[model samples]
Target: MALKPSQPLRLFAEHLREQRINLTERWMKAVFNDADLTESDRLTYEQLADHVPAILEELCSALEDQDLDQVEPSIERNAKLHGRLRWKQGYRIDELVRELDLLRQVLLGAIFGYAEQYPAFTRRHEERARYFIDEAISFVTLTSIREVMTERDRKIDEYTGRLERANHELLLKQKLVGELYESRMQLTRSVVHDLRNFLNVFSMALQMIARAPARTDTALALANRQVGDMKTLVDELVEYSIVLGDTNAFATEAIDLRALFDELVAACVPTVEAKGLRLVQRFDRELGTVVSNRLKLKQIALNLLSNAAKYTKVGEVEFDMHVCGESQWCLRVSDTGVGIGAADQERVFKEFERANHEDVPGVGLGLAIVRELCRTLHGDLRFASHEGEGTTFEIIFPLRLDTDG
Candidate 1:
């Protein structure tokens, strides 16, 4: 069997030592001295270096073992230990230990092979034997270096991939944090405002009763109106909290764009007549359908229409509906009202963000709810306005295909 070819044994042992030295140098001189190293990273590297001596002893013992069968088993056991040190007992230590392990295996294998082959020569030929061992060790060392470098590069690439994924997860977490904070702030404002309104109504009623022990019908009726305002304020606060709370609870369904505007106009007709304002619904019936939460969609439309009525003294609020493309439908509500300033247009969609309007009565949660509702439905809400001219708000949704439920 040609003595089972001693080349593999020599090659494995040479790489084992080269890898060990290279790793120890990187850790002791490079990684340990770097100021940027985290405390945790430094400690892991320290632990790895402390455990390397025992592993090197095993490599040396396997070289002298006379039984070739036992040599293979010893190499296998040590190789596994080396892999764990390089990859598992933590990253900082594993990095160096892995290299060391590779060098040990390479050098030990070369040493054992030369010993086995030279025992047959009777004459003293130390120089010739040294030359053979040196050539074999050099070739094996170069090959081991190339293999270690390839593995090192792979580890670096893996580290980079993990970093990018962690960064992306952090960004998502930040966005969720902002949403949760906003919800908490809204809850606080709701409680405070409701308490103030309740106190004001109770005080007014008590004063009216005190002045007239046997209350006149007209005085009682006037007190009752103040009580009604308190109720309306309470209802608005509750509704705002409910809509903003989970934003994702609404059930989605297919809706017709033109028909949705028509229903919205009908519901607001009574409010429009009382305010002496005209609402015109101009839409293309062919605009067709979209998939969304119907009740939530209606709420968004009613909020916009009510806002328009609140701001307009006598001008008209028109709904212009059309299909912009094959996969989208555009629904715009344009009003010739007090209008909005350029800066205020963006702020209007933020919670508690009210514009400067002395005539309009609001705590400023309507449009904020509208924007939130739009996002939940996978649509977009945007506005363009010129102060004192008019404001136009556009909403777009994905078209309902024939395959939609």
Candidate 2:
């Protein structure tokens, strides 16, 4: 066989092919630290750093051609993707430009450092390599700027549309101020009324505790219950604001659902037994590991189970789980307690409204919180209730196979 030309170009290309993955990882770590980039609430590393592999491969291909012209496709794709992500994450144009400048420097440094080890490489080869990367970086910068501007224009268009819609609504409602003012006043009065009711409960419970001696324990327990109610009111207020303000504040991880359920059941058993009720767990299928925000899931489960235990005075409270479908799982809690009436079904979901308006110590925020949480999990929160019979709350969390993403 005839001997093929074993030039520096072949050596460089081989290095890229062999070291592409390891090099990409190193590049990402460097970029992550060097740029002070916060990884959360932004595009993941896979999304953010997707273009690096293609760029490396293209550079290897370019070595054979003795030019950088063939690298345009990868560069353009990279620029657009990066620009889109930066725009989403609120990165300034200058910051993105600086990052690209640093990336180009780092990549060139690695390539040049490798070249320096080869005694056969000449200054002319070094200059050619520098020129090639410099041109490529310039192209990347231009494409990035163009894509960012495009995204900016898109956001502006969306804002304009929203404003126009608001203006249209205003024009329609201009003559309806009397109705709007009356509604606002009613809402204000309702809020004030609810606040006063809660305050009255607290104040009366404290008075009873102070006056009674023979019934001291009972009065103290009532007072403590009122304190818990006040704390729940405050917690619900905070949680409602947080859940409404930014649903993306938390992250999810893979966890064994069965393990979590076991913990919950064990914790709830004491309370259920104390209430003279039986706690029953029914597993329809094996609960494999699932991807979810553990704290939030715990909150959801705790609320449901606690509510079930709290309400069920006579019969057993049951917790059920099963694989509902190919990608969905269902968790349900049922209590044979004082159930919800049809009249209050819609009212209960409203802020500060309770199903057991007369006897329940809660501010009616649990179901509301559960509903908001279920929405975040890409799941549903629903219940079936018959007054004086029983109630069941089912929450379904769909499987996300792409955990660690």
Which candidate has the highest TM-score of all? 1
Q: Highest lDDT among the candidates is held by which one?
A: 2
Give lDDT tens digits, candidate 2, residues 1-405: 532443666666677678888777776666677645554226577865656677667777666566676667877887788678777778778867766776677667767777778755556666666666677777877888889999999999999999999999997798578776774575467557766776787677677777866677776777677677667777777776677677355677887888888988998999899989988898765668887788778878888888887777799999987888888888899999999899988877666667754665666667767887787777778889999899999987787633334
- Candidate 2: 10-residue stretch with minimal lDDT: 1-10
TM-score of each: 0.63, 0.50
Candidate 1 residue lDDT tens string, 1-405: 343444334443444455556545444444454454433253555564554444443443343232334434444444444444444434443344334434444444444554566663222322333343343333333433444555667878999999999989999999989987886787578657756765776676677688877765655676676567566666666777788687345566778766777788788888887988787878886777777677877888888888888887878888677887878877788888888987787678776677899557776778878887777666677788888878888888667532232
Q: After superposition, how far is residue 291 of candidate 1 from its true place, in Å?
A: 2.7
Task: Let me know the TM-score candidate 1 reaches against the reference structure.
Answer: 0.63
For every model shown, the clashing-pair count is 27, 0
